[model samples]
Target: MAAKAALPPHSPGIATGAGWARLRPRGGGAMRGYRYEALDGARALAAQVVLVSHGLGMAFFPVHSPGAAAAEWFGRLAVMVFFSLSGFVIATSLSRLVASDGSRFGVPYAVHRIARIWPPLVLAILVTFAVGWLGQNGLPLLTKTGDAYRLDAVAFLRGITLTFAPGDATFVIDRALWSLRQEVYLYAIAALAALAFAGRGARRVLAGGAVVGLVILTADRFFYLQSLALFAAGAAAAHFGGRERLRALARAPWLGPATLCLLGAPLLFVVRPGFIDAMSDGAGFLAYQAALGIPVALCLLGLAIGDGPAARAAARWSWAAAFSYTLYVIHVPVMTLVFSLRAHLDLAPGLAGTVATLLLALLGAEAVSCAAALVVERPALFRRILFRLLAATGLARPAVQAAPSI
Candidate 1:
């Protein structure tokens, strides 16, 4: 519990080179400090979006129900947002590693990533199992079944490796492990992208080509590419953006409204003609998603371009933002259990168990996630172990220089 409580907020700041070096080049002096607070706030917002979407689904529809056209469309869009957010955060974090190490090819680089992601995930699985046990044994929450066989320790060990073969969807604890696998792949690709591109134009060209290939392949195999594309955009921004230009763009009059329009159009058109065609299958789906990328990318770009009131507010709460990863890890199980209990409550129809379940799941996941962060995730000691495994798995490289002093 203490581990969870002491967890740091989510602040994805500029990655200075290793060991207290300056972020700018040796002669580039007196630049503005990187905003850690704003980055953390962005992470918090992304996590909240995911939580809210999950809450809506669990409360309003069966896990598989498509709902009305509008509902179905929104659900799919919510998932797109999730993928895009993952890309942004991953790219940002990887940039930090690259800046810190001066190379993306060593042990410490990979270790940092594993330490950042796995602790909360492991805790989530353990806690979720506990919840499942309680629900199944008639301790508190009602469950869907009594005979579901909890996977054995061996199965869990296998999942920890995340090497499940194709067509294998079995995850004993955290069903979300599949997404994590995709995330790992994207990180690797991004690292390679950093290593491969020696010039800005080449990086852009390569990334553009990759995005096109991804659209054509559409193999669920390359679902990670979708995230990779968004990540590439951020990476490109980092590589190309200058402080003066970012500041100038921040003042653009129409940026805010245009961003809103792009994001809002899909929601507004949920019931309109060709809406399903746009949101659903085939070329329409591709076009709709590409359009969505516009807003998602702009929102992130806005963060860099301006330090407006919204950005300032986000920075203010950055310290409290650390629990997003923990919350993400635990929320699914908490919500699953909550949804399973609906039948037992005898609630009237249209009362969508959503509100109550959301309130409880939010509160519960937060409390528990915080505890895990403090006790399990935050210890500086376990970081050693986490890094070693990730390095062993070829996930990252070592730092080439001391990290830049903040």
Candidate 2:
């Protein structure tokens, strides 16, 4: 993993009542203070929370589950956080690349992004296929046609390429694939922006324009474009909220808790019956999602700014952060398999059953995800292979430097 640059010292350190120290950065530095170390663990925790919420929603329908409403709302919020954080991280990294050599969309950057996303994604797809094949007779959770699991070669290929269309039912293997597509699209846009704007001033102008473009394009189209606004929000944060600004925000005693309360506010409405309907009809779902991005962006900013013991405590989950992508990609299939087993055994339905199912699914998914990360997601193993392939095909320069491990 790449070592993040340290924050510049500007404001004096302030001690919070809870023994946490707040350090703010000063302006006029070399612009090397933007780092992601504080946000890694928080991102991991958010991803895990998303997995848990998905498991709960899958195991117990919202209509039947007591906490399904909260879980559903949490799942959406977590994804938004993921997008915002991704934007921040990508923007920071791209700025570093540009600073290093003034090459924004180089072969190295492209290769690194591919290596980062494709391996775990491909492996997860294969695992999903295997689960679908083996559990065809029993896996009731997956969409099926006739007597076998529904597997379309075209849709699978589209998914592999991250080009699957929105509202496509072909993603039965893993509904989470949709977000991955959006992520890839955002990467492409970022790469273009980086390439088009070499100077710092030009990049700032591009970022501002991109934010406005995202909002305008996202109107009434909540599926993917709407999500881009969160990415733009993150980019804005990276552009304007330097280490000093972020650290100052982090110093606030109530910021973290306040962000949590803001995130939780939607639960009150989500818990109500027909809340989904209300959102779709009355609130204009896509518009509401765009609105929701505001608080989610704030949460991401809070997480990035936070430091001291609280940040360190979160960073302790670095292992989870390392395997978060694998977990996100494969959890659905693993959970589906667990649900199949539960059905095969005819577990009685109630609180106990639901708890057992949820626990089993979570444990199974974590175990599988960890194994996949160890075997295939490790950059040391897969990146070398990818580099060799790229080199042989002349897609990458022979002397291209290895990208910093994420």
Candidate 3:
């Protein structure tokens, strides 16, 4: 457990927080930081939270609704963790890419990006359409013959593009895909951020901090912007500090606990039915936005400092991390189907079923996502292309290269 909590050995091709260090090699070849397995484990935990949240929704509709809502409010913290971790992980990788060869960030990065994101996403979309088709019993859109298309072409395209410009119903592959749209935006923002911070020394850190603060203050409307800030923070921590700093902090420990408290603070304002209902729709939206940022920062800090048994357990589970993204993409529709089965079976929708169903759904999503990763997602060439195109288009950073493993 202690070994698990300790930071993974640094390596090349991963992102960095510090802009000061330049690679050096004994044999005239440059050295690089390696992937940290522990972080991946942390990501898997976040994905599970998202899964549990969706599962609760399934169980809530039929049984006790109030508890479900409470679970969702707390569980939804995973979104913040996802955003922050995205920033941290991406920033870390981008920093390393710049350190290696800033211009090398072309085709290869795109392939990595596509490989990491698209396959699972596409499969999830297929699952949605397939299930809708099956459930509709041949009726288009799952409605009567004369009724409107349920998973119509327009909705599918809108979701694929994630433009959300149409103001249509927010259903597609999964309701959670809204976060994917935001994630795309964050990817762009993180790239630009990486470019801005590729230089060495104090200015890079200050600029990074300023960018994060700027995004935090101004990115209220678009959740993607907030995610960029969180990623920036992670990138900053990785580049600036080392394992020693993390270990030293763990010795003291309060920082992690305190950050958790801060993360949980805003929830108090809006978690209650009265509070949620009391606020105007706009106010509630604002409150939720605030929660994502603070909590993300807190969670990242906890991962850094809390090397206790629980944190160690998370690190051990890090190998399961690659599937987090895929699991996240597919879990919702999977849950919808699973719960639909529960309904058909006349299973009691009590807490037990809800808990059991959540666990089973997670296991199922993990098994399927692992297969997707091994099959469609693991192809390195495609991801590199996607990352490069995103960089060239100024959608992300030209310096941020994609990792083959990702």
Candidate 4:
């Protein structure tokens, strides 16, 4: 979810004061000494899982089955992985900037975060808009035009800026954007925490107040409140992951394996979403989020430090992770396009056709995600573009590529 890169050179830490304006990500997401290939793999796995789960949901659309609920659960499980992994990776990245005895968001931090996250995200939003507009106007390729396909300008602004009130029922341009919204809140809290911890003063007081304000505001939403715990747990997990005592604790590299589906079906059976209205996916649907975050965080910590079969498999899938962020962000539109054509597909007459449609949807989404990644996500072009723009504005110089650090 954090999608940060243009990666820092293995330097002392992020620059501050005047130097902050010049910070730029140069090398790919690499750090000197060690590489978290496992983390990359986990990202790939989570993104793919979400894509497949959504595909499954579309396959069984207009029908309700244990499998359908199970599919939704799997997607939620993958979401937990994304949020947890995001926390871990973000904290790890924050380590460099914050390690210098507490830090505030210097210009470098803003530049890094904006450059890393906004480009691909904006592209995805635009693409979603285009796709949604066509569908809303009866393009025949977007059947399920929930909030995502609605071409409403106010919603677009709210979605892009993440201005929706905590737990507001308003959906974003893409359903996938919900996590991004949550991620924004997470980033704000983390930033304020760092600011609060910086050299003691009234500044800390202001930050502390902001934190309290954030907490009180988010408390209105189930996910908004519980996510703080998950995020903190993930941050703590990152800090402890490097400890010798925790080194061997991460043996299970895989987070939501196929075996977990057995549990999801049973769990969703007990969890219904009607009180807050099924359309909004209220408290009952979100109840498992924090609970799932704990295990997901642990499993990801294991993956980050393990060498088991699952870890090895994850390492091999590194290429897919390159586009994981792009895939996750843009998937709603790709899925909409694919599923729209599902009813039009002439693969077969019965169950086989349904199955084929599902598979095709998944494949189509992946294929499009890959293409979009090449254009936007790959090589961290977004960062480079921002860097260039900054340099043009005299806010930065060409970055000196360095060995990737977290």
Which candidate's TM-score is highest? 2
Against the unseen true structure, what C-alpha lDDT does each candidate score? 0.52, 0.62, 0.55, 0.61
Better of 2 and 3 by lDDT: 2
Local error of candidate 3 at 5, Å?
Answer: 19
Q: Tell me the tens digit of each residue's lDDT in model 4 across 112-210.
A: 566556667777767776776666566566333343334567756655676643222124336677777787788778777666655357777888899
For candidate 1, the per-residue lDDT at 330 reads 76
Cα error of candidate 4 at position 11, Å: 10
True lDDT of residue 281, candidate 2: 48
Preferred candidate (lDDT higher): 2 or 4: 2
Compared with the true structure, the alpha-carbon lDDT of candidate 2 equals 0.62
lDDT of 1 by residue, 1-406 (tens): 1011111223334445442133333322112233445656666665566666656655664433443445545444444544554555544454455555544333444545566666776766666666656655764443322335454465455555666433221343345455566666555565555544422456546654664564456445434445445545544443333444553454466766786676566666554555545453455555556456545654555564457876787667565566766776677677666655554565433554557666776777667766766765553545555555555766533332232211
User: How does candidate 1 fare on TM-score?
Assistant: 0.70
**Candidate 1 ranges with C-alpha deviation above 4 Å:** 1-32, 62-104, 131-150, 163-178, 198-222, 243-247, 269-281, 342-354, 379-381, 384-406
Give RMSD (Å) of candidate 3 vs. truth: 7.4
Residue-wise lDDT of candidate 2 within 1-406, one digit each (tens)?
1111112212112212211111112343312343345566667777788788888777766442447666767777777777877776676666555544454336666766776788887887787777766665544653222233345576567667866544232266577776777777677777766654553566547665774575466555435665677777776665556556554654566766776676676666765676655443454655666555555555555545555576677667755766788888888878877877777678857889978888988998888888888865665565577778888887766655554433
- Candidate achieving the largest lDDT: 2
Q: Model 3 Cα displacement at 392 (Å)?
A: 18
Whole-model lDDT for model 4 versus the true structure? 0.61
Which prediction has more favorable TM-score, 1 or 2?
2
TM-score of each: 0.70, 0.79, 0.70, 0.78
